[model samples]
Target: MVDADWKPSMGFIYGELRKATQEIKGALNDNENAYKPILDVIKEKSSKRLDTCLHMAAYILNPYYYYYDPLAKLDVEADDSIVEILGVLFPGDYELQNQIKMVELPMYKNKLEKFDRPIAIKACAVNNEKFDPANWWDSYGGSAPNLKRIAIRILSLTTSSSGCEIIWSIFEGVSNFKS
Candidate 1:
């Protein structure tokens, strides 16, 4: 589970999941029979859980991938997903709709020019490792309020329930010890 107070961005979680899957596959090359089931389960569950509007929105909104990573491709589907999530999150905001029409729609339509200005320039100067993206969104809230809200909500989510399971395990251990 994600921490109540803090969490890694969805982009980071997605990257980690992809890397872990690749590593697992690589390590089980000859022992495919023993690990294939595990791999299949991981792939199935991850595809279902991670392929959501919120995750896509968080991934697109992360500046490290948005401006620095060549692998971050923003397609129409991603735009639609972000828009859908935003609409759900902010149903009554007319300014959000206008912003999408005037800024985001044009940016998506002209992908080549999406990173041409202020964002690209600023993103290049920042050290991604040290930078807290949540804080960045907080600062950019005035300039890109809708996107900032989307980023904050989506990025705060944990990709898996492993954290909760770990906590449960610890609780069980303590309960058994007490008993």
Candidate 2:
């Protein structure tokens, strides 16, 4: 689920620890206090790294959340948050800021307007269909090139290196067996 190519799947990591802790607490019922310290540690660590700017931007760019799901409510401060990240990443780039104001923001607004339409509604309702958000951006990139660039960059990031560690462990196991 940490795969960079799967844009919609990337959001699964963002509150994962909190969700898991809540679920365990629910299951444990009266025993929750016994695990409070562990839960607190998980919450603390998750909060420290969970919602970085790239992750938030990826959520906004994900079609399943932003464009297709009418019930999905984006944070009200999303625009300002994205702008702040862009400012940090591209400081002193007046042209880029102008493009964000003139080009990207309008495109995002238009997409928001389209969210309640039949197409988006159907896309959201269909569970079996596999929609590639990157492909969608590829097809529509020409329409909003600057926004598309931002989406591509954010969505392409892997939130963690656990997958690489897993691969390394498997390789080590195989090498030890051979030795």
Candidate 3:
């Protein structure tokens, strides 16, 4: 059960997230030259939970980015680990419980560009059919053409950059499949 009135604030949630990050970082920092053993243990235990936390954080920070991650599935003892920290934000709800998808999407490396604007704006369209340029940019508060031009320009520049090779490759592959 989700709280309909729940509003997520970064400032309110940063402390908890940072604390978790710090716990990992601290463990790594304990032995600057040798973190393999510690990292292995952490990965064996909490990597899945950490990833779920990250995905949940993205969802909380931006409601439009609602996504369900299968790795969030909780074991009998999972709640005991995060109950104290996430309880404040997600009180009464069992977030760590979930079902895993038997099949998964193909993984492609991500671009380094700051696609923040599109990420926040298009989060709702994730994995949806209306994710194309024309459908996505159909709205305009006051100046639709100008916004469209800006988006096009930004996309063009980003694709031309080496950092966005992953994005270009994915687009190329997807487009080829359609044709």
lDDT (0 to 1) per candidate? 0.60, 0.60, 0.33
Distance from true location, Cα of 139 in model 2, Å:
1.7
Name every residue pair that clashes in candidate 1. none
TM-score: the better of candidates 1 and 3: 1
lDDT of 1 at 90: 68
Off by over 4 Å in 1: 1-7, 19-40, 74-76, 92-95, 101-129, 157-179
* Window of ten residues with lowest summed lDDT in model 3: 100-109
lDDT by residue for model 2 (1-179), tens: 55455344544454343347667777778486777877788767666466666566556566656654443344655445578767876799979877876776676556544333556545533323366555555555555677777766665555556867898999999889953
Could you estimate the TM-score for every candidate? 0.58, 0.59, 0.20
Clashes of 1: 0
For residues 1-179, write the lDDT of model 3, one tens digit per residue.
Answer: 01112222221222234345447767777664565565577656545543354323322222122122222232213223333334444456543221000111000001112222455354434433333322233332113233233323321221113435677899999889953
Ranking by lDDT: 1, 2, 3
Would you list the clashing residue pairs of candidate 3? none
Worst 10 residues of 2 by lDDT: 120-129
lDDT per residue for candidate 1 within 67-153, as digits (tens), equals 555445644565567678757866888687768657754453333343345764474346455555565556544445555566666
On a 0 to 1 TM-score scale, where does candidate 1 land against the true structure? 0.58
Model 2's TM-score against the true structure: 0.59
